[model samples]
Target: MQLKGKRVLITGGTRGIGRCMIQELIDQGVSHIGIIARDKKSLKELSEGYPEVKFIRIAGDVANIDILREAAARIEDKWGYLDVLINNAGIVSAGPTEELLDEDIYDQVAVNYTAILLLTKYCIPLLKNAEESAILNISSGLGLIGMPFYSVYGSTKAAVRQFSDSMRRELAPFNISVTCSFPTATDTDMMQKFEGVEMDTPEYVAKKSIEGLVNKELHVIFGGEQRIKDVEMNFSDPKKFDAQVAKTYDQFKQSSEGHKAM
Candidate 1:
């Protein structure tokens, strides 16, 4: 649907791809946005940067159920309807699963999966109240193809992909749509730990992802043709895909060393 004058609620909209998506929403004429993030100061700066827009800043960690509840309540109390809900907040803790810290694993699941479920659950009514509504979930390329060291991160994203599909079908009768985007090694704060990896710009990813939502596209898969082929290979030829992954197992392990962006 067209974004002009639409009201949106997004998580972690103050930094990384989420930040760029906020800018994209503004460019598409969205005037009212509700943002949930941990940094109150960053939320204030975001509002100042975009004086023409109305921002409902809920500064708290999305992993907190209370914060998710607060966001939906505030939106209903103010706007009464929502045109878009962007589940853009995510965290990654990489490395071999057995070697990973317990807290990091729990945090990844909480921030990357539980938040989406809780926030989306809370916003369903507001979405149905609108003339048309859409949900944009940001998954990862790793979610499409399992990798060695990114088990937790990939699982959370894969859950997002599955949730998007389920929600799309469930909300079809209500004139609501869901779009899931799979971005690979995006150049964002989440990728800061990687030493050397060619990545997609957060700006480009944000633009395409938003376009997918507006156009009602089912899936916005990044990483070009190779990523598509990899996904196909993993699904069609598990043994072959395993062999290919085995060849680069060491590389993934090395790159993911101490990777934490929570």
Candidate 2:
């Protein structure tokens, strides 16, 4: 589970927590990284910023199946195997589900859920080729506790959590570990629209998540003790959780208004 000398592939590694993770990986001694991001300029900048690291930059949208396939194919041709796969790219468009745009919903699903599934499918062979490998999936706190005004985003993240669990067991025989991270209200470009709220720094979240992957931990959950208590209450006493949600319904709706990052 050591990151030293590992060949890692990550999505959206050019910005926010993903970018911080790239730094964490380098700090942990990873030298070869394959990054999938939408901006060609950012990818180029990343390569330039870390001259010592060998970066395989694939500039394109993760939502595209072709882009995902291309990334896997490129990695196979160049590295033959992959030691780690980090599914970190994500998009969010929030509001009341009834008022949300259809296109935005589709985009969120394609980017956050389908891309993870397809990219992981394509990389399994490459991962198996390695002596030992690992997968880290970035989910959300909302995934654990289904909150209002974020149905689609939360569902996609919840899917990631499920996929991580299933893959952890399915890939056990192959010596591939799977880790899922649930981060809440992170202070990143993704949450720029929200103001006056306490949040976890992206650096802290990235550091912890990378540590979780290296330690082979199954889950790296943010949001502290309260989040855990809420998750427990949501699962064991749905009606009780509903009443809590009802209390903050207005705040949730207002925060979600025009909150989007894609």
Candidate 3:
């Protein structure tokens, strides 16, 4: 859908891909935008930085249902219709699943999965009212294949992938498009804990996201060469895929053992 003068709402709009998406939307002539994130100050900064646009900042943790519902209500009250809903907020708790903190598990599921579902549920009417509308879900490449030390994150993204697929079919009759993005490891604060992993800049993801949405592409997979390889491996050979994942686990175990020895 063309972004000119579109009413767009993006979760986690302060940083990473969300920030870049906001900028890209501005470039595409989006006038009214709503941002949902945890920090009020950051929201203010973004709003001030974009004086040419109308930015509505609803500051709250997306993991809280009340907070998300409140934000949705504000959007409904203000515009009464939504042209785009970008479900981009997510958290990552990398490492062995058993070793993850209890709070981490809860936050991952709530912020990444549940929040998106409920927010979409709340915004469906607004979306349907628009002449042309779309919902963009930010998933991950890891969601396409189970990987070592990223089980929880991967699972949540996988859920998003499935959700997007189902929503696409369901919303087809309503003329609402659903697009899911599967970006590889992106150079965001979320990926900072990983010591030596190469990542795509958030700019790349932002560019691809807008392009995919305009084209109404079903899935936008970033990370050129490695992304293609991963998709091919998983789709073509399940045994090889499993073995590759097993090797990654072995390497991670060896690394942990060496760290303990040191």
Tens digits of per-residue lDDT, candidate 1, 1-262, equal 8899999999999999999999999999999999999999999999999989999999999999999999999999999999999999999888888999999999999999999999999999999999999999999998888888889899999999999999999999999999999998888888898867898899999999999999999999998898889899899999999999899888878888978888
Deviation of model 1 at 55, angstroms: 0.7
Model 3 has an lDDT value of 0.87
Who wins the lDDT comparison? Answer: 2
- Give the TM-score (vs. native) of candidate 1: 0.99
Q: Write the per-residue lDDT of candidate 2 for residues 69-179, one digit (tens) a residue.
A: 999999999999999999999999988899999999999999999999999999999999999999999999988988888999999999999999999999999999999
The 10-residue segment of model 2 with minimum total lDDT is 193-202
The C-alpha stretches of model 1 lying farther than 4 A from their native spots are none
Model 3 shows how many backbone clashes?
0
Q: Which residue pairs does candidate 1 place in steric collision?
A: none
Against the correct fold, how does model 2 do in TM-score?
0.99
